[model samples]
Target: MNFGPPLTTRETPAQRAQGELILGFKRLGAVTKIDTLFQQGALKARLPRPQDPTLCEAVTLNISGGVAGGDALDTMVTLAPGAQLALASQAAERIYRTPGPAARIRTRLIVQEGARLDYLPQETILFDRFALDRELDIDLQGDAEFVGVETLLFGRQAMGEIVQSGSLRDRIRLRHDGRLVFQDATRLEGGIAAQLQRRTVADGARAVAGLIIAGPEAAHKLDSLRAVLNAAPGIVAGASAFDNMIFARLLAPDGASLRQCLISALEACRERRKLPRVWQG
Candidate 1:
């Protein structure tokens, strides 16, 4: 008599994965080890043998393939006093079109007194209609050094795909000894292609990259870094130094040209430090 529902079946809701990765490095005399590593959901981190005995390297991988709508990723890296570390991604990150909610990514870097960190991940490729919101927050203590780069591509040029409409919001914040030193934010929506073509914007460039270096030597190396950027081929690049930091902006016709310019700039900035081995291939 009470069978009004008639055995109705309820569809299961799709589960959107939320992933996080945390890595910590500490120095014992001249050697560094991955003192702490925690991974959950679809994110994983690996520590490989460093070519330099005093440096530690960590590579992050996204096992879920790529990010989609309703997905979230949070990453944190910490370096102990006097430690040296380099963090890179296994490959280029791909952002797929989101039908509803925008994908979110947050990265935080902490460098202790006298420590050094290199955050050099590969480019992030955005597919047509994709939506993404990303933020990078850096905290540095006394005499700590940081070198980081962020590269973005509108779409896969080699695949004959171009992004016409999409949404992207990116922010970068840096603090030294609990005092904010640098902050940058960018927002794009609707017809991103048309916006990027504006003279005041990318000026028809399909790829853009930013490199930031902060340390005691940043100001001293500004001229050399500017020279390297100026010598880059087929790329529009500029370098400036202020507030104990050296910043460079690059715009290129495609990702390949941008990568070349970035490699040269990184070498100049790091001095004796070499690019991450993953970048060679």
Candidate 2:
């Protein structure tokens, strides 16, 4: 029972034998330009129905055949000074079961001075034997602000399966004015989930998401942020300021909870930074 309409289809069999879809967006001064680029696509995608669509917008990328190794989706988003943009996926990104290949998605975001970028995509779930490679890069000016949250689920819980198979190679990099600020390169393989839960990365949590907020006032709002996170239920989260950036982390059991926590955290930061409440439904 797929609750909604059949997850929007992409292309026909004859047309999809090529590669997957690729959606792209570029923003300049509050306006967005989209390019639905596909390797060999035939089906069309529709708009997402988000709980609070006004806060975020989604444009279909490429929808070709099923995901496979060497398949890639490249996107570039640029913001002008004094402009702001919020972006999210239409739905939880799904990685279908594949034999030996992996789906790859690369996203690059650029925030100019005095501009802001908020990217809150839904969770990414990997089915058994599924392989995926994801890369996210952010380039920021000293005064630019950026917020991005990504949640990864190991396996399909409903099927009573665990993430014992396949591999995920994930990378994250953030730079400010040509200086490296933060970088994380991690690989998850056999029995890695158990190790991740022991004491380090995520502590065995089924879902995890990170929020990065950078701007002028990020350093002054640490105390208030602590209080807000303390109020969330069944959540282990933290906030800190470094190199003119304020970042937060939240670990939970699933994607919905993480998104709620993200909304709360964003609201707290907005209040302290005197920015508008962009998550309001």
Candidate 3:
């Protein structure tokens, strides 16, 4: 067996490449109908199996493959009257290290008259030195309803790795019948993660998750919902109902605890609204 050029432990000469990706969807129907599509790097939308045909629940979307580094993902979802939709990732969204520039994710949602939609995706975990910017824009009709949740973790806490480096920026805007309801932006850098770990700041927290629930019954569930929030363990959570919508917020050290709190709060709200738990697991 002949060996190649003097096996050097360190190789030299390198090449770099860059690319972009986008994923989108739209709904079309008068009463309980949906149309969807997606396009991304090495990812495509597959036809979902029909289940419980009579229910007015929205179509479910799952990201089967992980979003790779150096790949940008953009998604647009629309819902029509009497129709609803839900979107989620099959697993946690991983932001890998990129040799080029920062990765991006942008999502736009439109809800038509008397429709409902839920945009509950999986948690996003950022590795060391991973850079990402995400923006979410939501538009709802006057009588439409929308619920969404986003969970963010700085790094893999199980490895005892602290998010000492990296950058995460997120922006969100919600509009109801052309009326703005919520706007939030977070830019973390320059030891911000360490500052968040402080009790005075985030109370030794490592994860943050929030829920935006808006609809007709959102006005009367604050008291009962707050009671449920007070009972969840290992979480600091609260619920507020006013202005025809209810919002719930949760902060925890990990994703499991935060998800539990969200599930409980969701169930409580569903009960309060006399509606079935539409969250399909």
Best by lDDT: 1
Clashes of 2: 8
TM-score to native of every candidate shown: 0.95, 0.74, 0.78
Model 1 misplaced stretches (Cα beyond 4 Å): 1-13
Over 174-227, each residue of candidate 2 has an lDDT whose tens digit, in order, gives 999989898867687756457557657778777677777767777777777778
What candidate 2 gets wrong by more than 4 Å, as runs, is 1-68, 156-161, 271-281
lDDT of 2 at 30: 44
* Candidate 3 lDDT trough over 10 residues, lowest sum: 15-24
Strongest candidate by TM-score: 1
Could you give the C-alpha RMSD of every candidate to the true structure, in order shown? 2.4, 9.4, 5.1
lDDT of 1 by residue, 236-281 (tens): 9888899889888899999998998888888878776877788879
Clashing pairs in 1: none
lDDT of 2 at 113: 84
Q: Give the better candidate number (1 or 2) by lDDT.
A: 1
